[model samples]
Target: MPLVTSRRFFELGDTVWARWYSARKETWELGTIKEKVGSKMYKIFIIKYEATCIRHIDQLLKFTGNDNSLKINNTDNVESRNFQSLPLLPSMPVNAPLSEPSVSNLRSSTIVEQPVNTDAIDHGNGEEWGDYSAQDSVGDSTKIPEASDSPEASENGVEQP
Candidate 1:
């Protein structure tokens, strides 16, 4: 009767696939059957199935003969033990003093107040005043001589009246 139960289990697996297939509206095919030992007391059969002929798998397994003697092997204890034995390194102190001089202190001694020029300093070149006088003559038109109204008038007295 184990084969009948296994067949019923396979049918249950088909029901699960049918539910999913109908929900998604797609075709699925069955693949290899493998048994997995879950915990210490229960043996599970994982059936490989395909969806849309893509070679997929599904698992459908429960306790055999209604016996609840199955125990799940706990692997979390090993991780917890390793974590407990791990050495926590101390963090380095961040308040160490700097060995180099700061920008403010380095620039403080080098900054000297430049003396302001209160007395007029002579440049010793007379061309400076010549340029200034030229600029003044150009700016004031009264300094320029006006052209005489009589075009024939001569300064040396050699022209006609």
Candidate 2:
């Protein structure tokens, strides 16, 4: 039997992958459940999907080891204890049985050298700027135009005094 139902209860931070339907898209997309809304619906954040929207509990499935689960039922109900959050996989396995790498057994060499500036050396022309005051720096800076003060703004060449 699949583990999906309207009665399925998801708590905050409970991670779930669900199918989302889009009217404009005419397609269903997979998304993660970020919030549980009401009894049977959820707010899903779908990355790379054309559209994301509120989905029913039935539309949501458990993210099993293979990355999918079966949705089965629907009802307002108690939270599920079957699903306990395991830490999202660690970059390095802390709990794995392997012994930690021993640095004491490793060899090292002391690095002694003058500081090298790999960065481009400024030949001047005010292009390569570093550790300089605003007055000392020179370049074509991006300028963001501020909002016009006039109550009526013009898109065309209408000059206002």
Task: Give the winner by TM-score.
Answer: 2
For all predicted structures, in order, the TM-scores are 0.13, 0.30
| Candidate 2 global CA lDDT score | 0.48
1-161: candidate 2 lDDT, tens digit per residue: 88865455676544455544333222223356677777787887654343457887755555443333422234312132123222234542212112322456556689989886645456566555455544545435744454553445556444654
* Overall local distance difference test of candidate 1: 0.29
True-vs-predicted CA distance for residue 136, candidate 1, Å: 54
* Residue 152 of model 2, lDDT score: 53
Quote model 1's TM-score: 0.13
Q: After superposition, how far is residue 63 of candidate 2 from its true place, in Å?
A: 0.8
Assess the local accuracy of residue 80 in candidate 1 as a C-alpha lDDT between 0 and 100: 23
